[model samples]
Target: MRLADRIAVVSTEDAVRASVSYDQLRAGDGALYWLETRPEVGGVATVTCWRPGEGARDVSPEGFDVTSGVHAYGGGAFAVIDGTLWCVGGDGLYRSRLHDDQLELVSLGSFGDLTIGDGELLAVRESEHGDDLIAVSLTGVPDIRALATCRGFLGAPRPGSGMLAWTTWSEPDMPWDRCEIWVASYSPRGQVGNPVMLAGGSEESAVEPRWGPDGALYFVSDRSGWWNLYRWDGHQVKRVAPIAGECAAEPWELGYASYDFLDDGRIVVAVQDGPRHGLVVIDPDGTVRPVDLPYTSIKPYLAVQGTTVALIGASPTAAPQVALVHLTAADPQVEVLARSEHAKLDGAQVSTPTELRVHVAGDREVIALVYPPTASAADWRAPVIVRAHPGPTASCLLRLDWQAQFFTSRGFAVVDVDYLGSTGYGRVFREALYGRWGLDDVDDCAAVADHLLATGRAVPGQVFIRGASAGGYTALHAVAQSGPFAAATAVSAIVDPDRWAETVPRFQRAHARRLRGGAGRVNAATVQRPVLLVHGTADDVAVVEDVRELADQLTAHSVPHDMLLLPDVGHYVATSTQAGTALEAELAHYRFVMTAAAAD
Candidate 1:
């Protein structure tokens, strides 16, 4: 059952990776492909197609990057008309076409500030306070609205001739801080010609417009503090790619998001690296190149037919993969083609496993995301998993997360730690939980679970441990300090950190002053093992009355636990039936601790 063989499902785990949001037409028949997944987990987004002349390329196993928000942005989706492509996901606005030779799917609608014009399709099915109504869909589908009007649409497709231009602002202003970029002109006899603002949003921040060849507008601004690229020329706007760089790319103080046109005067832009991402390129006379590559994070799309981009770097072992590069291939290399297979020897060849970082107390360091179940350790055995991630501030930042690729493809040896108050190692490691929080995030998750059991890499007592939400209060305070872990779980958890700071709510009463600690508490005199809880009766943010008051204090001290709950969830358990109810309460408490750690 190791069929992760292309059409996309990727998980040759070493810490996951992939990202190429929308390469024209997009996914399935929309052309150029190779993606992994994410749209809140299980909307499958595994792709890898490339059809044009039919050099024959079509890979898809993933699905669900949702389609209407609330997580379904498997890069929103592209491919239009001719071959038919337009996906957002599920019952919101799908569409797939190409039939017999493949491409499947066909109808879906929900419409909102959309775009895609030429044969026509512009939108804004609904909006609020600022007032709305600006539909228009001739053939781009959506129960054909021909023209609705009240004006407020924006991209999803609506740039060229369908004339999908719009602008509006009214509350505390932040549509680029003020607003104005209207340009209506659609007429199959619907008459529209009174909207010509054509670019505004000042104090700076015009945005990623596009269409300068014969119409002249192009965009991306920072009013010149850094984001570069300008152009208006009906008598002044200037600068086309004024990039200078110490590493330019900082326009998102509040969204209009990155740049992307390539051929309308070439460009890509994202840049930053060594902290997150950096994938530059430009020209209109400023010239820039920086796409060197040890990669920090990337996703540069653009294969509209040529200039060929489709990138997606990421490294520390893996997570994020897709490459094509062909700015006209001077020496331009990078053809990875497709990887991410190991769901446990489904043809092996993973990579990302060497960030061990030990210790915890005052000398911090913790960090993790390992997965060494064996790619050679003289043929490694299994049983380890500590795992945690639940935004200890949001980042275990090492990508390819197929739920830790199903515990190292069914053999088990995951890690995913990043303790000591995690978050892309910055701002003093996200204020190392400011004050003190659960003793340096509980000795950084019991020093990444006893540094994988004093480095022999585990076998000694089977080991388990888990987390969710502040790493489920650091896996119930690392099983109440001193971690060995025969078993442990805690979905939507946060056990009694003093009633999560007095009946936690008010968006978390200041998160218990950032987890202060040391007077010690996580009781049942430091749990003995078998715990598993998994709440979610519509959790109002980590609430099942705090897992039924910590499962009645772990069943009045008998310890050995089991809870469950979940129905109409919250705090996202990330489906597959909540990962089969956390793999049947973690393999029935590790098969009763692997039959009592093989009878001691």
Candidate 2:
């Protein structure tokens, strides 16, 4: 098929979308609820429930914006209690009986981490001062009462008999950086007693606290330099099957669950090893066994009912889907409950990624997933597109990405580079870019491209780079610092580090400084290749004005470039329309640069 046809295939509304988004996995009463975003519905959060031998059903009320806006990057938006569905919506907290078609607004306010217990919804409410733990009565009365306050941030409020366990972290420290699990005594009268620290401290990061059937607190902590599971035995915490792998990810938002305890005391958890993940079950004696699964990517959202573990997972050939795996089965039965959407590509159209570990400066290593062009009969060497993933802290996994295939299916080798600061690696690796952000991330991406060239995987002088947000910053830096990249495309790129920091939340501003550093600046004059800047006017994170200023500067320096201003869009290309436009703009940029190179 033609490149345009491939792009159209991936960009169409019916294309397979990722169903297992953040904090969308919840299970109760033998049923599992998976929150999905449908382009047909303009990417609205829709809850789909599944039961044994039953078909999937849409439980969310029609036309309700059941999404959480607590931290901007929403997650932990919905939770199911005793077959009743409670979700955060625009007007406040909303509830829908699992089998009912009617919706009732229960509370009024933005909330996160909705944990159900004591006949109420306990969540972290976003207030003017900061985030606090509050209990909202499940009755339609909208009676909101504060359970805990004066904390910079609070999450994972697991309510149990006479106790409430949650995680807290102050500003200047992201959840994965430093957080503590606190367990407090609770009373029926909405009274919260003094809290006791279960695990974590200034130098340790603890998250995802939950109470088991026996009322023993369980959580994940990075005290040993890896995010591993631990059991809090009222007075002390003990490591559960300590391993070298990561059991928790960067808690960018609320409602991150790496593991859940089964009724029989067995624990079903997802452990991330580099970019791939493995589902494992741990007996009380600490005997760990891997569950048979075909997926290479698994989210932190895990729900366990008896011996069955439900998670959102994906393989190289399949988009992410809600999966139910029976742990005790002789073969570890795996069942895909709900998919993101029907995949538009056949098995031949999918590009399987080959892992690439390149040793860069000082013998330090960086990892990336390289997808070769999928043209079976192409005669010429394929061009390469090196993508710097966002969240300079986020790692690129080996999942089926339609966008990456959109390029590979059209004779372009796409490389997803996980730079120095990416997670999934240990904390030491993650903090590698602490004092060196733009420089290290930029160099790592370039290194991946250079490695591909050296190994004869890419066509020389035909390489391009593209990214959005922080990745965009790295893409721009790569062009400015060291690049003969045919062309560069940056969506909402950070032109100035200092200016970008101002737009970030106060807690994240410090990390922004670490990424940009004192000498960080985007010199338009230094850009040798053509550039394309795509931004949305509604993006408050990397405000459109900041990106526009960079585009103007590029023009002032007479740098050949193009800019696309999308109105009413946010930091992300959410809607199908926005994604289609961005994909087309990127294609145009690549074509323009290739033509210009040919002329030269």
Candidate 3:
């Protein structure tokens, strides 16, 4: 098979049709429910329910798109309350019983972080003004009551016992950077009393507030330099089975449940150490024991009922699947609830990632995941691609990434750089990019490429760098600076940090400014290498105009570059029909660069 054909097997529309993404796992009333995002259906998200005897079935009402627009990157869009599934459909909030087709509209608006309250649904509603907490009536004619109005962002409005808990953070700080958990007396009639600051501050980031089975408010805090579980027992807050690894994932979206309570009063928590993820059971007496599982990566959303846990798990060889684990068994067995129809690849076709650490900046070690070429050739160095993950805050996982495999299977080595600002590491490491976003991230990517070339793992003058969103910004800057990279591809790249800060959504305005932190703008004049710029016309986060301006500058400087702008596409291009086209263009761009360099 041709190299392009091997790459197409993972990047084409057929691959998208064969793939599925599961999110928001929730268990209640002896059933497991989750949101399945199918790209074949135009990325329509629907709720599915599965039971012991009965097979899995879609429970979302026909013609209803179960999604939320609260934070733009919506999550926590559905909740199972009293046997009825309440979800944010395309036009309004709706409720329906399991296996029933009767969908009743509850309210109209963009809402997320859906939680079951006392006879009501608690959610965070987004509007032009700002975000606010609201209570929706379960009965009567769609009575929507504002529980709390805040000038900043609000999410995870969990209601338990007689109190309602939620997270709030203002501008200039992302939730992971800084946030507070608040609690208030909640009445069944949708009335809320004065809120009290429970736990969190500028220095301590707290999130994922859940009411424990013991009526204590449990949450995740990074006070000890790592995101660990904490419990608030009416008057005092205390750590729960404290561990060095992060027990909660970054709050990119609201309503992530990293840990859940079992009926036996034990806690099932998903802990992430570097790129690997595993489950640990914490006893009431503060003992933590690892749960043996085959999956290497677990999503943040999980639920526990009795000793049964429902989660979305993935490994190097398998796509993510919704699974149920019975912890009470002698050897806990994972029950496959739903698996994606991905094309099965043999061991020879798969490239497993290994940890690569390089010391830079005078003893500061940088971490990365290196995937060597799966196609073997004697004494031939492979071309390398250094990937800068977006979020600038997010870390690359150990899960099976078809995109990375696309290059590895085609005789290209891929290195995913986990720069200073990336998560999965502790807070100190994550916060290292606070004032050095573009600078440190760019250096890290360039350094990784340098190390690969120096160690003979990468072909000299054939290394390329690529990224999306903030990582795109890093790639653009890296190619502009002195580096071993021969070419660059930036998707939805932030061309100008100042402009990005002004045009980005209110939630991340401060984050943009903080990340930029005294860094100069991208100097297109310094970019001598070929560049490929891919952007979506409808991207609100990194507006298309900025990329256009950068392209104009590159043209003015007589630089060789190609630009691909997809119409009607948003910030994320992974699932779009145009994704395959973009990938092909990128591969061609790199090949052309190599050919030109070899001729010279």
Candidate 4:
């Protein structure tokens, strides 16, 4: 088979267009509700509900695109309350019965983080001024009222037992950096009393506040150096379970739940221990036990009804699926509800990753998931693609990544680096890149390449680096520093930090400023290898103008480079056509660089 055809086997345009992403899992009164985003229709999101005997069906009306624009990257778009579904559509708020196809418009505004309260619908409404926590009466003629407004941002408005709890953070500090959990008395008439800070401060980050069945407030806190479970009994805050792993993730989007309460006073939580993710049951007495399951990667959002837990899970070979676990069974079984298109690939085409720990500057150890080429190679050595994950704060989980497999099937080894600043290793490790973003992360990527080369797993001069968004920023810096990479590709990369910080949404402005860390923009003049720049004209996060400027600099320096700009595509090159085009262009660039190297 031709190289392009081999790559197409895993990442064809048809498969990309047919791909489906599931998010915001919620369990209603004996039904499961979640959001399904279809890339074929330009990323139209719709609400879906699944019942035991009825099967799964879409509940969102035909013309309604159930999505929230809050925080620019929206989630928590819909909530199920008392068998009725409340959702935020493009026009405004809408509510419908579980099986109804008609949607009743309640209000007009941009909202997210939908929460159910005492006869009210709570959400964070985004406007030209700022974000505000608003409440709409479910009983009356949908009376809308602003409960609280902040100068910075507000999200996760969880209401329980006649009280309200939410999180707030100001500029220059992302929610994971520093945020406070506040609570106040909430009246049935949609009135909020003076709020009091329950936890979180300059030295701590608390998020995902939930009101347990016991009327106590439960949240995740990083005060103990690891994000652990904590409980507030109205007067004092106490640690519920002290696990060494993180029970929560950074609030890039709203409505994230790492742990949910079970009816019998136990908690079913998703825990991230390095690159591996799993579930555990925590008893009220502070005892914790792992839940045996087949999947290795699980999203933080979970929904529980009775003893059943609903989550989105994936493994090395299996694609992400909406699954339900019946904990009451003799042996817990994962009942698959919906699966992604990649699930059709045979097991032989899959490349599983093995965790590798390497030491970089300051002798600090960093984790990297190394996947060997799946194709049979007589030479045994293959070109390596070193990938830096976006969200300098994000960790790459052991899931079925189609992009990674697309290269491995064609005899290219892939290495996903979780550098010094990655999460899942605890708060201290996550904060290690505070003032050393580019320096530490870049060094970590280089060290991984070096380790692979030394072990004879990668061709000495055939190593390449690539990243998107923050990861792309790291790749650009690494390739310019005369690293071991033969070439580099950056997609929607942040070439100018100052420009990005100013243009990005209010929620991530502080993150951009912090990640820059005294480092100036990438000097395209210093680049020494073949560079490929892929960006979308519609990318508001990292504007296309910045990439154009970088391309101009590369041209002035007489550097070998190619730039591909797709029109109308957003920051996330989500559509199948765009993704396939980008992947093909990237593969061609790598092959051209290899041919030139051979000629030399």
For residues 1-600, what per-residue lDDT tens digits would candidate 3 score against the true structure? 765344323445545554578899988767888998776666678899888899898988765678887766778899887778888875678888866879987877788998877777788998778888988777657678888888788999888888888899986578998999999998777677888998888888999999888899999999999999999999999999889899999888888999998888889999998878999999899999999998989999988878889999988777788888899966888888898756454322567777999898957888889888764554447999999999988887787776677677667888998888888889998888877877888888888889888888899989999999998988888888778999999998898888888899877788888887645578889887889999999998999999999899999999899999999878877766577777788889999998998999
Per-model TM-score, in order, reads 0.28, 0.94, 0.95, 0.95
**Residue-level lDDT tens digits of model 2 in 131-155:** 8888877665657888888547778
What candidate 1 gets wrong by more than 4 Å, as runs, is 1-123, 126-162, 165-184, 187-265, 269-290, 293-296, 299-370, 373-380, 384-412, 415-563, 567-571, 574-593, 596-600
The clash numbers for all candidates, in the given order, read: 35, 0, 1, 0
**Whole-model alpha-carbon lDDT for candidate 2:** 0.78
- List ranges where model 3 is wrong by over 4 Å: 1-11, 62-64, 82-84, 89-92, 96-106, 344-348, 375-380
What clash pairs does model 3 have?
A: 172-510
Estimate, for each residue in 1-600, the C-alpha lDDT of model 1 and write its tens digit. 443442132332222222212222222234664434433344245444656466334443234342333111123333344555444444455545533223434334433333445554444333331233334343433444434343333332235453434444333333333344555665542545665666665455355555555576566554554445666644567776555431222211111235555664666665532235566777656677766655466543333335656655555445455555655555555655444433343344443455677766666566676676534364465687777777555455554445554455556677777665454443345445755655676566666667677766767678777888667766776766556776778788776665666654432344454454642445655677777888777665566886787788879888878888777665656532355455556656767778876877
What's model 3's TM-score? Answer: 0.95
Cα lDDT of candidate 3 equals: 0.84
Model 4, 30-102: lDDT tens per residue? 7888888777666777788899988899877764678887888887899887777889887678898866878
Q: Evaluate model 1: give its TM-score.
A: 0.28
